[model samples]
Target: MVTVNEAKQLIIANTQLLEKQKCALDEALGRVLAEDVIAPISLPPFRQSSMDGYAIIHTDITQKGTPLTISGESKAGQADLPELKPGSTIRIFTGAPVPVGATAVVMQENTARENGTLTINEYPIPDGKNIRRVGQQIREGAVALGAGSLVSPGAIGFLKGMNMNEVIVHRKPKIGLLVTGDELLKAGDALVPGKIYESNSAMLAAALTNAGASEIEVKYAADDFAATAEALAALIRDNDVVLASGGISVGDYDFVGTALESLGAETIFYKVRQKPGKPLLFGKKDGKLIFALPGNPASSLVCYYEYVLPALRRMTGWSDPFLRALQLPVRYGYSFDGERDEFLKAKIEGSEVVQLDGQESFVIGSFAVADALIYLPVHQNKIEAGELVEVHLLPV
Candidate 1:
């Protein structure tokens, strides 16, 4: 067995970054950028009007009620605009390019137009009041987005505005999931004695998808050693990472460890000093990662979040690839006497975190509503209300 920090360090040290790939900007959402994106052209390439107003020379309007001739109208996307005549104003719409020599724009609400004559209603029209200068948002040949940035919906739109059709990003990892158990039955099947509904496959699959994994293949195997070994070998051969959800413990039916050993896998760590997922096993074979998780549903999911998820993110080139951590106060007092570090399901209520019920490795009721995990160290046995504790915020 190894300490939690030691296990994490080993996983990080052995994990390698995947190769980069070109992805269309439309399909780059949730992907990490492998290179910086430079602006091809300046935003609002020309001086633009920010409001539906009249563009005029500041010197032409000196006081309130000053009248000037209306030359022409300039709408958005219009080219070959009429020239600004001396002592004259031109009607400009929002996003329309302002004509040369126009230094200020007076909003329509602050001006009165009678026939072709425009009168300023508000006095002292300032220069550059409503004009968006050239390159005000971004200049051409400038870095728009830096490398290692996560491409979001807003980022797509921004890149599109810069006329980018594609971006280079770290490719998502291909995963293979193997679920092992003989006493589990698929949902909607007839209930039989000594058998329960199988849920680890569906649960872990959903979690993997939520973490941005796209290429995934799920397979099932019985408790028999031959079947388990065959499934593990196939998954390792086909995917960059393989996750086996059961058969890692010391039970008589467990065969994952022996199967891995038969394949000559390098066991990085077999167990950790943590509650709910102490039997977690991490190993590598032929440059592929393999994790043998605990049989219990809650235990498997916890191991996925704490260990497997970080490895996947790191492989995909994320800079900080762990669950977000914070220090928060507990809503109520609690006590525990255990040598293992405990991760209790919790929900953030206002300013404090409240520990929920049903923390057993086999039960997931509390996990359903949990948005955070309150981590209690082995050295700390008791906590008082309003005491500070370490909290790991879940991605959900």
Candidate 2:
């Protein structure tokens, strides 16, 4: 068995960033950019009004009681006709360009209009206030976004403002999922004695999808070696990574590890020094990565966080491939007669994380409301109610 850190290194070492492709801006969310994006033009492109009010030269308005003649109207998308003269103001709508020689805007709410004239209700106004200047948000020729960063909705909008309709990003990985167990039944199937519903495939698939793997094929293998081998063989073709859950223990029908060896898989590591999920297998066959994970729900999830997520991020060219782990104070008292590194399902209570009750590795209910997991190291026995503990946050 290897330490978790060592196993993580082994898993990440094999990932190669995938090929890049140009995709439409709409489809770029969650994808890591493969190239730097430079702004072609300044954001806003022109000087524009920020309020639905009157635009006037500061010197044109004398006092709160004075009224100015309405010279013209400037609506959004309309060209500026001429400069504003002294003692004159233009009726301007929000987003309309400030007329030339205009230095200030008085919002319509503060200005009372009588016929074509305007009376200011507020006394003094500052020059050049409330205007979103040209290039204020982003300048032309500036590096708008860096490579290896995931594209978000805000990034898409910013790129669109810069007239970028397409971007180059790393292609999402193609994943294959396999589950092994004779005591597992598919949904809608009649429940047999000693049988449980198959859940690893669903959980693993969701995790892979959220990690940015766009394609996934799911399959299941029975306990028998031939059945397991046949199932894995049919699913592994052209896959970037294959994840097989269950059938990795010492039992006779724990066939995944042996069956994979028969298919020529080179094992990376067989186990880690972690509780609930110690039996994990990382390997490669025909240039495709394979993960033989433990069947327990919590174990599978912990393994996914520690190993699989980093690999997927690396394959997608993420600059920071590892998700951030936070160290939060424990709000609930607990004790561990530590023999292995244990991950306990937990929820955040303010800045502190409270470990949930009945956090057995196979129970899924405790994990559903858990927003994080607290790791307890070996050789430790007790944790106080207020002690700081490291927590791996679940993706929301």
Candidate 3:
């Protein structure tokens, strides 16, 4: 048995980043950049007006209620008609390029119009006011984004603005999932005496997808040695990572761990010092990765977040490796074994993580209402209500 932190370190050290490929901006979402992106042109491209008003020289507005002649009207994307003289102003709309020799803008509400001329109001005019300068947000030829940065909506927009249509990014990894049990049945099947619906497969698949996997293949292996071995072999051959649920504990039907060992896989870790998910197995064979999680629903989710997610991130080439969780104060108190770590299902309420009642390993309803996983470390008996604990936030 090993601790979760030790297992995670081994997994990250073993996995390498996937190959990089040139992809269009639309397909780069959720991908990590493999190359630095430099800005080809300045953002905004030119000095422009920030309001729907008039562009004028600040020196012309020395007296209150002074009137200035209107020279021309300029709207966004329109050509700058002419330069404004000392006593002349140009009618300008929002985002219009500031005309030559103009350094300030006055909103229409602050000025009154009469006889095709505008008069200044009570506000004092300042030079270069309400004008956005070129390259104010991003300068030309500067590194806008560094390598290994995750691409999001803001990143996509920034890349496009910088004329970066294609980018080099790490390829998403492929995953295989296997659910094993003799007493498990798929949905729409008749429930036999000791059978329950198979749910871990679908849940694990969804989680892998959310973690940015390129492809996911799911299968069911009955509680037979040969059948489980066959499924495992196929998965190892087809995917970069394999996630198997159940058949790893010390039971008659627990053949997943034994099968991998028989196949000459170096079992890096067998069990973790954690509750609700002690039967977690991690190993490698032929340069491919595998994870065996307990069949219990809550345990499976906890293991996925703690062990599997970090491995996925490593495979995808994320350089700054760290798990994201909401560190909040506990809302409820409970006691646990002093030698094992525990993850309790909790809901975030008014900045406090309220632990859900009846959080057994098999219960799914509490898992559904849970927004985070509150972790209690080993050697701790109970967490007080106000103690700050690390929380692994879940997708809503």
Which one is best on lDDT?
1
Give stretches of model 3 more than 4 Å off.
122-124, 320-322
Error of 2 at 132 (Å): 1.5
What lDDT would each prediction earn against the true structure? 0.91, 0.85, 0.86
Tens digit of per-residue lDDT, candidate 1, span 141-222: 9998888888889999888987899998888888999999999999899999999999999989899999999988999999
Over 4 Å off, model 1: none
Error of 2 at 88 (Å): 1.9
lDDT of 2 at 184: 90
TM-score of each: 0.96, 0.91, 0.94
User: What is the C-alpha lDDT profile of model 3 across 21-120, one tens digit per residue?
Assistant: 8889998888888988888999878888999999999888888898999989988988747978899999999999999899999988889999998998
lDDT of 2 by residue, 203-269 (tens): 8888887776778998877788999998888777758888888998899889998988999999989
Highest TM-score model number: 1
Cα RMSD (angstroms) for every candidate in the order listed: 1.6, 2.4, 1.8
Identify the superior model by lDDT, candidate 1 or candidate 2: 1
Poorest 10 consecutive residues by lDDT, candidate 1:
120-129
